[model samples]
Target: MSKSSIYLPAGFRFAGVTCGIKASGKPDVSLIVSDRPLVAAGVYTTNQIVAAPVVLCRSRTPSSTVRAVVTNSGNANACTGSQGDADAKAMCAHVASLVGCDETDVLVMSTGVIGKLLPMEKVKSGIEHAVAELADREEAFFAAAEAIRTTDKDRKTESRELELGGESIRIAAMAKGAGMIAPNMATMLSVICTDASIEPKEANAMLRRVARVSYNRVSVDGHTSTNDTLLLLASGTGTPLQGDSLCLFEQELTELAIQLAKQLVEDGEGATHVMQIRVTGATNDASAETIAKTVAASPLVKTAITGGDPNWGRMVSAAGYAGEPIEPAKVSLRVCEELIYENGTPLKFDAASLSATMKEHPQVNLDLCVGGGNGEAVYWSSDLTTDYVRFNSEYTT
Candidate 1:
């Protein structure tokens, strides 16, 4: 499959290599390096059993000072006790030495099956080869994206063009996570790179706000992973940027991030359809979001939607358990204006017609009403299927 790419910043480059880590012949380790220190920011999974690289990267990135990113696939490097930590540090140190950068300047990420050990000897040689080929930046991006995928069907990518200070600024992003999703609705890894000048503090703040509004809003099977990381680095190569440009850049970043986030859920293992759950009409936007997530996460609701049953009761029941103060008697539900429920009672509507529509479009709207809070949220997700269970049950085998 031909993949479209994001426009990377000037100083960044990437490369990938087969480290004999995975049984497959494909590349399993990758590298991304910046010629100079870049403003880097990261957001990680809330999962308690976080991977070794995630733990290490979190320690390095919050300083907002980063120069390189070392990544590996086919081994998540989690639950390996002290050995995992040592392996992660060794990987970073090897990559740092190859790239002639400080160990503190390198950020590490690992993905794939959990409770696995990385082949350090193979990984070290791959890093050496990748460093030797750092002359091509564009290839680096593609390699980086390819190196992190687990069960993804295709590479997910997005980019945006922006004008800042009479200069053209480009923000590009890529991600992968077709399963083990559901970190408040997302379990994915993404990287965004830009040629705009911004402070590390500013960039870190922007990424946090964007992640909350975008990636956190999506869900897929409600299964979060131990190694979910989203990292963004600013090159400052184009122009000295701040103010509205920064906000605009962040908005574009969020959009691109969301695109990849939703793509992950849509292509999730055994997912045949993509659904958008939009919730509106609550005491506040936060309440509306809470209500929407409840419905989206319900196994019963998702299964009903998969079968095109349009079960309104399941939707309302989810909202009822959303950990928010919501009154069923004052709430309403709708499936694309069908008015499935009103005032806590089922609204007589054309279930057959709505179900047919569900088989056509990729959108799903589930409006919940509690009061005049008028909150709204959009969550991208997929319905559960028998194939989904089978795929996950035998994934590592």
Candidate 2:
């Protein structure tokens, strides 16, 4: 997206700068700031080995006082012991001082290499430069999005506008993720900004509910990151959405988040096709999601998608092994809208036609029914390609 096409939310400013943190000399540090006090909520990775930045930000959010987020790429600050913890806090402290806010009012996030110490001097300098350059412009917002990227092929941004309580509200978000993704929380580092008024408690609840159906439903490579986090800040410059208005705001938030999540899947490392796996007729939503994730995470299924092979056996067996209650005799499967399997019997369909359809489109949809029930779920996944393996094998070299 270009600067002219983007939306800059009211009361928010963004900045991104380079400070030698990345060997490629790209913009590696970014800041998202608000000119006024705002309600904030966050969702983070569920990995047991959490990153220092995630720990610090998790304790400071779901508040009404947060003002800024300082982030850096090229160093994840994960598994680096106590020094890593100290570095994370220092980053926040520096941003707080620069922005004239309390230490707790500044949140921090880091991505890139894991198990490495952050170059604090460079990070501190970058923070100073970013704070000084902060601007309320679409170019600045785009820069902030670019600065958080690691293996992503493109920067991701989305915006939504809604009319609530006779007031116009806007929600804009940016995210960075291309690998090490799973449905364990936010799945990546994302910053969401809005001008709608909301309470801290309500914002927290809404974030979780929105994340459940959006971020949590996306899986890329099935590996969860240590620094995955999604932070939402509401500037409350518009009318406070309540009653039906609050519900509408949440719906828009969900739609915006899903757009971002799909972008991440599309940008998955070396990805060629994105699979929209839908599971229906399960016992419950949770069970449906389990089956969907299993099918999406299957290496056999992903590779089949990469080769445009209409292989229904891999998908059926994946759902059967999801540990959920599944009756093979009652299962149905479709690949690229072609019913290839039904009720434990394989159908003789035009496999060449189905394969050609998969090859012609970047999005491949698979529908699976595990049993006769009402539960349903959808998951976004990327096809496993040789390029994906090659890129990951040389990621640290």
> How many clashing pairs per prediction, in order?
7, 0
List clashing residue pairs in candidate 1: 14-140, 181-223, 185-218, 282-373, 283-373, 284-373, 285-375
After superposition of all CA atoms, the RMSD between model 2 and the true structure is: 1.3
Off by over 4 Å in 2: 1-4, 237-239
Give the alpha carbon lDDT tens digit for every residue of 26-111 in model 1.
77777788887788888999988889988998888755457788888888998888999999999889877877778888988888
Instruction: Write one digit per residue (lDDT tens) for candidate 2, span 289-317.
Output: 99999999999999999999988889999
**CA shift of 311, model 2, Å:** 0.7
Residue 150's lDDT in candidate 1 = 74
Model 2 CA lDDT for position 317: 93
**For each candidate, what is the lDDT?**
0.78, 0.91
Worst 10 residues of 1 by lDDT: 1-10
On TM-score, the candidate that comes out on top is: 2
Residue 125 lDDT (model 2): 96
